[model samples]
Target: MPHSQDTTPIVLTIAGSDSGGGAGIQADIKAISATGSYACSVITAITSQNTHGVSAIHPVPLEHIESQLDAVFSDLNIVAVKIGMLADADIIQLVARKLRQYTPKFLVIDPVMVATSGDLLLQQSAISTLKQELIPMADLLTPNLPEGAALVGKPVPQSEEEMGALIADLRALGAHSVLLKGGHLEQDANSNDLLIQPHSSELLRAKRHPTVNTHGTGCTLSSAIASYLAQGNRLHKAVYLGKQYISQAIAHADELSVGGGHGPVHHFFNGHVNVR
Candidate 1:
């Protein structure tokens, strides 16, 4: 159905499932909904994970993933789509094909490669698929230090300037805009996140919150960006709003602690304040 009154934006998250509810599809749904957008989802994989780390990952079959996509796209308005972990090349190709067929307005991709514990998540075969199919389709791409390095085949960025430079190179690789996350290495407890647009070398800096509970920050940020885009915000404005939302979520993370190790950000920080 079309959006009621065409005011509330509808967003879809195509990603893997997180049993522990800290990251992946779980985080995506939480983030999008928390931002006042209608959230729909198509799960790519079912993962057994917790605060400590990922225990097991079971990728859904290619056909099943496509069916899930069809079910959502055929029924929902789907103003924007936020794509997360697709685990393997076949899954990535499936998602790419569906995107080509449906062609959603705003596509935000979060290139999830490694866990917070420094464990590899995406298979090597999927790298080519992401670069060839997904990145080019993305209106905006969000990648952390490790994911960015994996995409560009370079070393971890040493400085904010270097990261911005690397982000520009990455945008040239495929994405129209890039948000290279600096959550991996913050200077003086102040994290730096940069958003670079096409035809412009200037990097837009966003204030980062210093918090250890960042298990699903990348997924949450990308989803929030998609939600904002669905609501008709400009590219830079969407990124800025997403930055603020994630920062507050991170700052309030301690109160929403669910895991013993790396925990989730408070996606509903505004909702909590409204209740008070």
Candidate 2:
């Protein structure tokens, strides 16, 4: 048997499975492929969810989760990793341990705490473990307003200055870079994301689109960032490009009528899938 020489960079997503195909591993694959990267996934949980809300969640067993990680790392050379929706402390510990074992070139962690429909995703106790273990290992941490508030032990920032301060506090927790997403802020014409590095901070802005099809914005954005990173883009450049992609996706989200509630962004807004 011979393996095909697929030289395209591979980005692995360790996340949950959304039945609606709007977020989680589904969105990750679409976003990664849209950015011209091969996407591999290890599902940590399965959720009965749609654009509206999550009705139930089933966390994948530790043994199976570990087996999936082993299978991916053993066969593929992953360039970057995007993490999302580890439901509990045990899963978080397992993921953190595996990351230490198989260190990818770029690791983007999306601290998914709650769903757009206000359903709690991550367990309350898992928050501490995620901060103490996973945050330190991540190359970049992407948190929306509510998740940021949960992580930093305070309310989400209300202004640009407050966002900067929140970034500083988040950096103190351990991630090399922190990107505080502004989607959860008050409705505005412009969506601004604050990216904070060790020495500097940058605000990546995009035109806000008025649409309810925002089911998986966080998952899509973080996966896009990981995809660009795998393609050798700099951290800031990756974030900027990811922001652009999501903005376009959001802008054209209405093109698809997937669900009655918050629909997903159009991941393949360009009308062509990039995977080989």
Candidate 3:
């Protein structure tokens, strides 16, 4: 069988490798392609991980990282970029430098600090470099509750007013826009996410699904947003559509049994007429 040579917007993911095929660069590529963008990748770090947890990490050398970025930006007409886990200060600095050089039209930064299994992905010392350099370059910052709190140097809020305040504080850190994910906020019947732009704010509401197969929700959402942006959708609209896509993914994650703990969402759920 052969595939069609269709022309689609290119989206580059500069992120870490997930041996589990569930998160990091793996999830970014899946979400980007599933949302209609051609996906390219630059591996930042390789992690020994799976459904249970991450055991070890090996950061790619700075020279290799630079080479990969040059290779992609030189040839592909990249419409957008999605960045995930960069394990250390050196890697973060390297990524920030490359981003400044290429300057893609849209950049979605997912500050991947902690993995779903409560393992630390980013080094503590790299937080400063990430905040000072990479975050300000992002057109959109997608951080879950804990990551958002870490970014703002505050505790996770327990109320809507508190969440709104957090968004403002994060935007003050220089990101053009912020999607403060509320999924980690005491789970209830519904999940609420906040999107803050320069002059407006929106609280996106969706029904929360009960499942443990949410290993890569943040990566998926941010990559989907980048894909939508590459397809020419506006920021707010892209965020909304990305939310809808992730909700359905989480809702239907039970259809597959890939691993023993915290399995991945079924990224190909919409590829068929009947997903049974």
Best by lDDT: 2
State how far residue 225 of model 1 sits from its true place (Å): 0.3
Q: Per-residue CA lDDT of candidate 3, range 1-276, in tens?
A: 443333568899988988998888998888988888899999999999999999999989999999999999998888899999999999999889888888899999999999999999998999999999899989999999889999889997877778888866887979999999988865457889998898888899999999999999989999999999988999989999999999998998999787899999877788642455
lDDT value, residue 190 of candidate 3: 80
| Clash number for each model | 0, 0, 0
Q: Estimate each model's TM-score.
A: 0.94, 0.96, 0.95
Q: Write the residue-wise lDDT of candidate 1 on 1-276 in tens digits.
A: 554736769899999898888899999998998887989999998989988899899999888888988998888888999999999999998899999999999999999889886767899988988999889989998999888988999888878767866855687768888888888776735677777788764454555666678889899999999999999999988998998888888988877747789888888887644423
lDDT of 2 by residue, 1-276 (tens): 543446578999999999999999999999999988999999999999998999999999999999999999999989899999999999999999998999889999999999999999999999999999899988999999889989989877787677877866888979999999988766666889988899888888887898889999999999999999988999988998999999999998888888899899999889884422
Query: Which has the greatest TM-score?
Result: 2
Candidate 2 least-lDDT 10 residues: 1-10
Return the candidate ranking by lDDT, descending: 2, 3, 1
- Candidate 1 RMSD to the real structure: 2.3
Residue 275, model 3: Cα distance from true site in angstroms: 8.3
